[model samples]
Target: MKWTYTIQTEGLTVEQLLRDEWRLSKKQVHELRMAKGILDADETPIRWNEPLAAGTPVVIQLADTVSPHVPEPNPDVSIVFEDDHLLIACKPKGMPTHPNDPGQSGTLLNGVLGYVHAHGGTYAEHVHRLDQGTSGLVLFAKHPVVKNALDRMLEDRQITREYLAEVEGNIQKNGGTITAPIGRDRHHPTRRHISPSGQPAITHYSVTARRKGTTELRLTLDTGRTHQIRVHLASIGHPITGDELYGGAADSAGTYKLHAFRMTFIHPFTGKKLTAQN
Candidate 1:
C-alpha cells in the first residue's frame, strides 16, 4: 500500500516524522528504511536524516498484510466512516467485537473482513472494543502503521468516546466525575469492582433525563478499563439498566442500555478530525 503526505511544518526530518510525529515502532522504521519506502513526489529516494521544507510531498509504501479473521460476508454490518487508513462501523448489541477463538464467524471483525476483502483490501483490525451487550461505533485500522498510531492515541486519551446509557436510579447530581480504581471481581469471571489497589479509572457523567424509575446519562471516559462505565455507575448506586452483572435491573430485550453514541479523533494518516455518531 502506498500513501502520500505533505510536510505541514518546515525543516522536518524523516527521522522526526517517523519517531516523533507518527510514533512508528523501531522495527517498522527499520523495515521502511530497508525497503526504501519513503520517497519524494518524483519517486526519488529521500534521505532519512536530512530536513525537508514545508509542503514537500512524501510517498510511503508498505507491503500488504493478510487479515487474520475469516471473511463471512454479512450485509447487516454497517460501515459509518471509512478512509484509506481507517474505518468505523456500527456494532449491534449482543454481538462480540471479535472472535474469542480462531475460525469463528459472525463476530464484528469477521463481518468487517468480508467487506474489506470484497472491496479488494486484505487487512482490517479493531482499534478498540465494546462489550457484547453494548451497541455503538467501533473503530478499525486498515493497516498496521495506522494501528500502532491509533493505539498510542488511545493510550494518550487523544481519542474521545462518549456513551449514552440508562441507569436504574435518578441521579441527584446533574453532573459528576467518578475517580475510582477498578479491579476484577474474584467471585465472577467477567466482572469488575472498585479496589484501592486497582488501576486508576475515571468516568464523567451528566444526567440527561430523569424518569420515575431510571435516569438517562451521557458519559465520557478518561480511562478505559474493563467494564469501567458499568462499574463506576454501579459504584455510585446507579447501575445501568439491564446490566445484571453489576446488580442492575433487566431490560425487556435482556441486554444493557449502554451505547457508544459518539467518537472523535484526529485521523492518524490524513491529520483530519473525524467524528462518527450512531
Candidate 2:
C-alpha cells in the first residue's frame, strides 16, 4: 500500500510524523524504516531524522497484505463514508461485527472485506464493534497506522458515539448519568450485570420521547464496557424494549431496539472533524 501526504507544518521530521502525529507503534516505525518505506515525492528514500519543510510531499509504501476476513458480499452492508485512510459502514442488525473464528463468512467484517476487494483494495479492518442485536455505523481503518491511531483515540474518549434506544418505561429525569461498574453475570453465560467489583462504566442519557409503554432515549458513553448500556439501563428499572435477556418485553423481530445513531471524531490524517449518522 502506498499513500502520499504534503507536509503541512514546517520543519517536521519523519520521526515526528510517524511517532507524534500518526501515533504509529514503535515496531511499525522500525519496520517502515527497515523497508525504506518513507520517501520523497521523487520516490527516493528520505532520512527519518531530517526535517522537511512545508509543502514537501512525502510518500509511504508498505508491503501489501490481504485482510484475513472471508469475503461474502451482502447488499445489506452500506458504506456511509470512505477515504484513503478510513471507512464508515452501516452494520445491519443480527450480524456479528466480526467473525469469532478464522475463515468465518457472513459477518459484517466479511462483507466489508468484500467491499474493499471490489474497490481494488487489499486491506480493511474494523476499529470498534457493535452488538449483534444492535444496528449502527461502524468505523474501519484502511491502513495499520490509522488503525493504531484510532484505537488510541477510542481509548482516550476522543471519539464520540451516540446511541438511540426505546426502553420499557418512562424516565422522570430529562437527563442523567449512570456510573456503575459492570461485570460478567455468573449465573448466565454471555450476560453482563452491574457489580460492585467490576470495571467502571459511565453512560449519559436523555429522554427523547415517551410512548404508551416505552420511552425513547439518546445516550452517550464515557466508557465502553461489554453491554454497558444494556446493563446500566436495566439497573435503573428501564430495560430497553425488546431486550428479552435484560428482563424487558420481547420484540416481534426478536431483537433489541438499540441503535448507534451517530459517531463524531477528528480524522487521523486530515485533522478534520467528521461525523457519521445512521
Report, for every candidate in turn, its global Cα lDDT versus the true structure.
Answer: 0.92, 0.91
Using TM-score as the measure, which candidate wins?
1
Q: In terms of lDDT, which candidate is strongest?
A: 1
Q: What tens digits encode model 2's per-residue C-alpha lDDT throughout 1-278?
A: 88888888899999999898878889999999999999999999999999999999999898876787788788999999999888999998899999999988888899998999898887889999999999999999988878888998998899999999999977899999999999999999999999999999999999999899889999999999998899999999999889989999889989899999899999877778999998
- Positional deviation of 68 in candidate 1, in angstroms? 1.3
Which residue runs of candidate 1 sit more than 4 Å off their true CA positions? none
Query: Which 10-residue span in candidate 1 carries the lowest summed lDDT?
Result: 68-77
Clashing pairs in 1: none
**Candidate 1 RMSD computed on C-alpha atoms after optimal superposition onto the true structure:** 0.9
Compared with the true structure, model 1 gives a TM-score of 0.98
TM-score of each: 0.98, 0.97
